[model samples]
Target chain A: MNTVIDTILAHRSVRNFEDRALTREQIETIVRSAQAASTSSFVQAYSIIGVTDQKKKEQLAEVAFNQDYVVNNGHLFVFCADLYRHEIIGEMESVDVLPSIESTEKFMVATIDAALAAQNASIAAESMGLGICYIGGIRNDLTKVSEILGTPNRVIPLFGLVVGYPAKINDKKPRIPLEHIYHENEYNSEHESNVQELQSYNEVVQKYYLERTNGKRSDTWTSQIAKMLEKQSRMYMKGFVEEKGMNKR
Target chain B: MNTVIDTILAHRSVRNFEDRALTREQIETIVRSAQAASTSSFVQAYSIIGVTDQKKKEQLAEVAFNQDYVVNNGHLFVFCADLYRHEIIGEMESVDVLPSIESTEKFMVATIDAALAAQNASIAAESMGLGICYIGGIRNDLTKVSEILGTPNRVIPLFGLVVGYPAKINDKKPRIPLEHIYHENEYNSEHESNVQELQSYNEVVQKYYLERTNGKRSDTWTSQIAKMLEKQSRMYMKGFVEEKGMNKR
Candidate 1:
């Protein structure tokens, strides 16, 4: 496979990072790649904060459940699903452009625009031989993030991404089989034969955890998810989003 | 700049395509790249339906407001925000995983996941010197898409992407400057100077449209968006999402 395919197919989360800092040029390239992604109606309704401040990084690490890489990574990007930019544009043009909750479709388009742009940056970083990890924990303390970042109303932190040189290479985490996701023309969840095939996958995942952590927890995928969902982590995000002006339909 | 970075940085929409068929290996590699993206809780809540059949592609293009490139492209993919797979997994484990609008966070996560993954595929294809365009018009007729694709409950079509070799290279579209998007700590729309900056952009966009369409209509970015949002395009998406059983908090 070509280098592009290689970078993509061989993708993995890189939490540990080297001490080298990302140069301004590299950061510009990454964000430029992000901006190159298609936006709905050319309304690039998103903003990324390139956080390089040490104290701020430490605070973000705390917010992200003490993920050490947040403080150590060369570039910490907090990607926001921003309606504020467009809102400002509307204000300047003297137009009332706020689509209501009845406009669930517009909301989806804006959110998807932010997400697609973020992934473009991730892919570009990986292709440039940089390691990256997405910090969903940004949502864990959503209200704090908005306050810390001085994000105004109509823009919410969707997620954060930490990018840098890898301190160490890690083994790949196993994903649920391709069949579990890709459907023919319709969604076929009752694939009895695929369910039977998952037995081997359970074993595969069990071995992966054991080998990766050296038998630290020995948790299977099923148990991992069960444990995760059992307790509400960011259940407050609903109110947080509403407070941040992302009132859903 | 390297080829990959150039491919990414110089990215633009290619609304025309040759009739050459894409190889299966190309599609598989792109999908694999997509699958390798960071999914929320490893749920991998997305699916890509690769449309190679001519009749189906034509119908899909029609659904997307007669976007001729979609039907004529080598590949057209419907990217769905899939929750039914996880719901089935929930059932197999005898756990209730019925996602609701009340489960608003999950819905957003799934939608974001789908967008992120689809974007990786788009980037991968682009890096390999392919041209692609995203079709948000799929949301313009969600019920028809669901029916046509045989999508089940909790699976919504977020967007569609058309991929193939470019028939011609289009001029790069101008983006709003970084000063407009990059907020240091919080959103600051106080800089009224952006209006003047946007006037220059309006000129660039107008020239692009005039050159592309032989001056059929004089349009600016604001005019385009205003035209698009003037009608109720996705008027039924809220009720459609509710009908699909995603009644969350």
Candidate 2:
């Protein structure tokens, strides 16, 4: 197997980070790699805010549901889905091109575009021998996160990524078998038989959490999601995304 | 700067591909990298259909509006946003777990998860010195692409990626300035100034197309998007996604 593939397959989210600051050159390379990712129609509807200020990182940490890693990380980047670029073009050309909920196509494109760019940045960071973790809790309270990031309309903050040298490596989380997800020419229900495989993996996941959390609460993957869903932890995200002028009508 | 950074910074789409077959080991590495990307709650809500069969690739090309590159590429990967795995979990537990439009959170996570995985796969391919081009045309007619790929409900075909050794390296496309997209702490409205910078880069983009097409319809970046948006392309994707039992309801 290729070295990169080995690194990828052995991937783990690194929350603890060495107390070192990332060089500006490092940030530039990661951002450039992000910009290089495929964009939908080259709209490039994404921007990343590199937060280095300690005070700001603390604020961001608070907004990211108080994740300690956010504050202690070497670098914190918040990826935003932006449409203001097109709005500028529209204004210059005297057209009404700003995306709205009616323009669901554009909304989807921008969101996916932002995601692709963020993913590229993540991969690049990993290749650079840095540990990284994504902060999806940025959506836990979108309005507050947006306020903290100073995000504007048509520019919803999707997630934050914390990057640094590894203080430690977390074990790789187990995934449901491919047979459960990959289907042939059409989606065949027969592939559903792989759920038992998932159950087997659940023990692996339980062990992972137990080791990490010292068995305070033995959380299985299913229960984690079930609890998350039961409370609709990030439920405000839909209204929040719209309020940020993403799915406008 | 590292060679990987150089490669990523100079990234460009490669539409015209030469006849080449990707090694099996290459496919395994790339797919494994995709699997390594972060999954939402470790759900791994996605899958890739490696379309190596020429007959199937030809059919896919037809559905994607005859994008010849899809058929000619050494590899065609259909990256799917899958909820099928979760649905099976629901079935096994005798629970109703299909995500609805009201389940906007699920939709968002699944989409982001799948795109992140695809991006990892793309970077891994690039690291191995391969060319990649994403096929958004897969969404031109979601139903057709889904049927062609045998996609299941709650598993939407987000995009296709055509990868292989490049026939030749194309010049890197210039990006919109960081100012145009990146905001400080809040959203800024100085996008008008950014547009001026874009004009010069737009020329670069136009020149790129001209060089590639021998001056055939040298459309600038803005004009290309205008032309693309002129059609109702992907306008029905939202409804189609929902109709496929995705219940983006």
Candidate 3:
């Protein structure tokens, strides 16, 4: 009911952005807001690449599988889980930093740090009456993205944020009921398989797609997920992340 | 510069908490804000378990290597990157979901989703005049934490959040220079190894620790990270996530 919660719940990833560019002030506020997010152990292990050059945007859009919004949004910011800075700092101090960089825990920490910053940026943009979309599809080609951004080893582009004024608004998608996604004191699965939760949500999603796409696809949530997961998708991310020298174990 | 940015930049993880509990309304508002965070697709692939019982908190604190905030906070919420609900939904519809569950991309997505949610929760709590801390140490013994929480397969506790009134305030830690974190156009490492940026931050961190701890530790960020990383920390998370039936590859 609070303004913060209201902002959080009313979120819908906006793809169609107004043609007008965001003012310099807005971008500064957004990025500064991003910096304000809490970092694990104050390591601040993340970086963001702001892309406005049309050609660079086009390349990134293609890298994100031609997600046009990457090219057309008010701005595109690629968030990277970066430990490279830590390495640089260590090198300046003539100290070792790899043991922290190579482990899964630190990798997850950096990943989460980037994510927290991205969300803060998203919320900040939205607070100013802007629309935004998270471009996870950016990971569709990590190497190309790193190449485009001049990212070195020990940095991985976790995801991108496309911020803009809303040209179109998508309907709010239904989330699972609280009972299914929440537990009281311990991990409770008694209701995980409950038909009441599953069947009802399926119906909601079925109607969502039907109405949203003008009946182009009439499928339930379960069916959609099953279809998406039936075949291996993005299986190369492991080796790709390893190639980037992240979480190499 | 706005209220949102101010709230974010002012964020300090408070582990020393006043001995008071969050009201039902407060918890509801905070959790709802968490639920509102963006997810990869509409998967909503995350869950939160709030631990209130003294015994349960004690057990979890021990699991987190005796992080007393887990037991002392107004509330403790364990944020889990959960695919188990998707699995259950898949089962109700008679389909396979492991392929998606086991991939690095999906694993990263779920982890990011939980992090996004947790940060929102943290911000919401802060906005409500509360303090919060993220407990990544929950992963120190993921299996034991899951056991305490009764977590099923495909659901891993990403981290814990301790929310309460601040009993103590830590001085703000200085982050790296904004230029270092915000790159323009491409992945420009042109200044990544700049000793100028490195030395200034080292002094800032060196002074921060020295002043905060009454000169108990006069270490710089580089030296601290170097010392911390020189030895292995949390080497068990990879195997732990795998044991939880996530990212099996």
Candidate 4:
């Protein structure tokens, strides 16, 4: 198999990192690759905040509920779904951008673009022998993250990417079967895998977590989903997004 | 630089593709790499629809406002932000998934997951000497597209990706200067690039489109944003997303 495919397929989230630092050249090249990702309509509605300040990273770690990767990684990249820049560009060119920027479609466009670019960054880091972790925990407190990042209105810190040389690699987790994730021309929920395939996969997942933690964790995939979804999590995200002038039209 | 980095930096949207068919092995490998992308909380909240039926591609092309690439490529893979499988899994396990599935944060999570997977698919295809074009025009009329694809609630067709051997490669467009896109430690709007960097990049982009089209197009970067953001394009997307039972608290 090719190296790119190898890098992609073998990805595992790395939270542990060595104390060594990444060279500036590597950092520049990685972000350059992120900029090279395909953006919708060339809107390029995204930005990256490179966090190397130890104090700031520590604060962010707290904001992410003590996810130490926010502070312990070689670098932290805050990927922003930014419509603020589009507005500035429009103002620079003497046009109103809000007719679109303030709408849900554009918000999603920006979010999706930010995500695509961040994935490119992750892949780029992996190709360079670096390990990466996507830090969605930052969304637990968007207000604190925004204040820390100085993000203005119309800018949402969608997620963070922590990149470094791996100190430890967790056992790879199994995904749901392909037949359950891929369809032909139409949405197919009637597939046997969709309705009846969870039991086997749940066993796989249960064994994975069980073995990963020396049998300390005994829950299956279904139980985890049940616990996580039993109550509203991150309901404030919708409010935060709307407060950013998105979805307000 | 490595081949992976080279392939990434040389990305350009390819609309014209050589009329060719991809092998089953190649298709399987590409989707496998897509599944390798990280999903939030192991939700795996995404699905891919591979459109091989010529007539179906034609109708999707119409849905995407006659983007010929949607029909003219070697493969059209519809990346969907889907939570239906999670619900089924919940049902199979006899747990409630609606409390979280009905929230907006989950929708964004699924959308981000699908986009990450699609980008990986794009990268894997590119590494294999294939071309790709991300067709966001699928959202221009998602309601009809849903009917065409039989997409049920909680399954949004985020975008379509066309992969093939390129018949013609457009000149790669220049991105905004890195200083504009990447912030250090905090958001830096005072940087010279933020307010004053577009002119030079505009020149680069203008020259690119001008030469690529043989002087047929002369618009600058700012002008394109001004034009695209002048009106509310895809305004119906908000309603469609809500109707799909996403983004509703």
Q: Model 4, B55-91: lDDT tens per residue?
A: 8899999988898889988999999999887777667
Model 3, A1-249: lDDT tens digits are 566666777888999999988898888888888888888777788999999889989988998889889999888899999988777766766766676687778889899999999999988898888999999888888888888888999999988899999999988877777776778897777763556777888898898889999999888888777776666777888888877777775
Write the residue-wise lDDT of candidate 1 on A63-96 in tens digits: 9889898888878898888776565556555666
- Weakest ten-residue segment in model 2 chain A by summed lDDT: A95-104
Better DockQ candidate (2, 3): 3
Candidate 4 residue runs with Cα over 4 Å from true position: A191-193, B191-193, B214-216
lDDT of 4 at B21: 78
Candidate 1, position B44, lDDT: 67
Q: Candidate 3's error at B84, in angstroms?
A: 1.1
* Best of the candidates, lDDT: 4
In every candidate, how many clashes are there? Answer: 11, 9, 4, 0
What is the Å distance of residue A155 in model 2 from its true position? 1.2
Which segments of model 3 are wrong by more than 4 Å?
A: A210-217, B190-192, B213-216
* Model 1 Cα interface RMS deviation (Å): 2.6
Per-candidate TM-score, first chain only? 0.92, 0.89, 0.94, 0.95
Question: lDDT per prediction?
Answer: 0.75, 0.74, 0.83, 0.88
Cα miss at A28, model 2 (Å)?
A: 1.0
- Candidate 2 per-residue lDDT, tens place, B116-191, comes to 9888888788778788999988877777777777776777888899998889777676776655555545556555
Total backbone clashes of candidate 4, pairs 3 or more residues apart or in separate chains: 0
DockQ of 1: 0.50
